[model samples]
Target: MGRPRVTVIDIAQAAGVSKSTVSLVLQGSPLVKGTTRAKVVEAMNELGYVYNRGAANLRQTGSKSGIVGVVVNDLTNGFFAELAVGVDIVVQSAGFVQFLSNTGESIDRQREVVASMREHGISGLLVSPARGTDPSDFAPLVEAGIPVVVVVRSLPGGKLSSVVADNPSGVAGAVRHLVSLGHRRIAFLGGFQDTAVFHERLSGYRSAVTAAGFGFDEALVVPSAPSRAGGADAVARALAVEERPTAAVCFNDAVAFGACDGLRSHRLEPGRDFAVVGFDDVIEARTAVPALTTVSVDPQAMGRRAGQLLLKQIAAGGVSSEAVMTSVRLVVRESCGAPRLAAQA
Candidate 1:
């Protein structure tokens, strides 16, 4: 009742060539003459023949499935969105399709997505892990021999390759810059205490404060949600303290924006009465009122680098277990009061 499926043999017969010639054409082997390849392709088209890459990969030894899995904790954030775009650019150019998933900072969701990717026979994975992800979460993937390249957030003591921005150095630069501006009382705002990023940044903040001959005050550190509302709340709390901070280094651009809002609500100008600095110089940061001063991580570049790393692991058929900490820079803007100071000078 059903029509017969067109096989490579049918294409070969239609083109007056051997089955081997059709196979060669499918593989894009240069061994076959261009004219022969053209003939085979034409025959395939005329006969309605479709090449089954999955079936072919199964027959070949160590052939790639040409699929890479990319998972991020939060796709809603512009930073992560740009990072995913970067991964896509590199992975697409390498003749690979990416299965990208947003975990929304859920550990269970991350585990589910990774397992699904494995079931689909992905050659490699690029992950920006959700909060609270354990080393054991990746054990199944590792055992299955799938190469994984972690991006952005990293899992400590795990034998997995990772690409992350230099968090401590970036935070240090922010702190140093704020201190140089003659702000004696500076606050570290937003971000929960549990994450590695928070720890690294806090360490840098403390080190920079002490290095600059300022007393390390634990009261100056305000832990909150890393969201805009969280930033606002953190600033409100900071203001209630006996010796309110003059400037604040926020967790991210969203937090910085929230801090600015909080300042405005209190009839205080953000750049004038209270200086603010943020991390992840997102696009909005450049255009915001009294544009945000922040750390430039270049999310897209990081994503592309992550893609390159994943491809290498896929090609090698094993994880390199290397950790790459990409560099970050401080981008000065109006929000930090640097521009006004320069003008005055």
Candidate 2:
């Protein structure tokens, strides 16, 4: 076997200090006295230990590499892109560079990206998990003492900190607006059924539909891929129902765009022929022909919040189990056939 790898613990033993002290020295903490820091540095130098840093880099509670990993399941989504920009804005200001990886909703790709990031000595990790990814997928990172903050998705019982939008309230408000506008049958359109986010948003749709003195129609609940194409296909299915719905609350802006495309293919105009409201007010929402009406989840703000929280956890030298739920609002635009009000949202 090759010679054993050197560790911070070995450096601590050589320097006659506790492992915590070695960790503090590695972290460049001001709390470590100059002399102690010097001694630890001398020990590390003498042993030629430069954080060859396997999971061992993570072994030290607060040691950092000045880099963080951000893994998103679907980078193609503009909302996720905006969210990533938000994360970069915060982390860059804090002197940490972000390593971003897109998994394309592939669990294997997610695993590969995470492993690569870990090997690169990422001080912390921020992730929006892919579907079918178990909470346990994060166990190794946690065990290695890496601070992890999940964004846009919650890992129930994952013992990890998370930042997510208030899905139920956002969708409920959007549905209420639709109901108030004299829409008798409003469909909830386009999203995969497996995700917690989908269920949460669907729950809001159901609550609002039933609370507005309307029976919840299961036929109006259509699950799709949560993509533009998925939205288009879902709309076609909705139109095929015996009693077709007049309006829809889409899973996201992408789906909303797709729904509009689908409507056009059927020679139906979105604002004139049917009403559509979507979540995640992406940049395209404002520029679309009829301008999309959507729930403003402010993905960038959520990204910044996630980045800030992870930095806090890193500095605190422990795991943060805090669950931060950000608020949302409905932005009325033409797609929903809502009149331009005094002010949007």
How many residue pairs clash (N, CA or C atoms closer than 3 angstroms) in each of the candidate models, in the order given? 0, 0
**Candidate 1: 10-residue stretch with minimal lDDT:** 48-57
TM-score for each predicted model, relative to the true structure: 0.81, 0.82
lDDT by residue for model 2 over 1-345, one digit each (tens)? 333567878998999999999988766689999999999999987985645344455566666578889999888889999999999999999999999999989999998888778767888999999998898887767766789999887888888899999999999999999887788899999988888999999999999999998889999999999899999999999999999998999999999999999999999999778999999999999999899999999989999999999999888877768899999999998998877322343
Q: Write the per-residue lDDT of candidate 1 for residues 1-345, one digit (tens) a residue.
A: 234668887888898999988888888888999888888889977875656555466666566588889999878778888888898999999999989999988999998888767656788889988888897788666765678888888789888899988989898999999988888999999987767888888888989999988879988999988888989999999998899999999988878999999999999998888899999988889999999999999889999999999998888877679899999999999999997766776
RMSD for all candidates, in order, please. 11.7, 9.8
Candidate 2 whole-model C-alpha lDDT, 0 to 1: 0.89
Q: Give the TM-score of candidate 2.
A: 0.82
The parts of candidate 1 lying over 4 Å away from their true place are 1-63
The local lDDT score (0 to 100) that residue 32 gets in candidate 1 is: 97
Model 2 / residue 18 / CA error / Å: 30
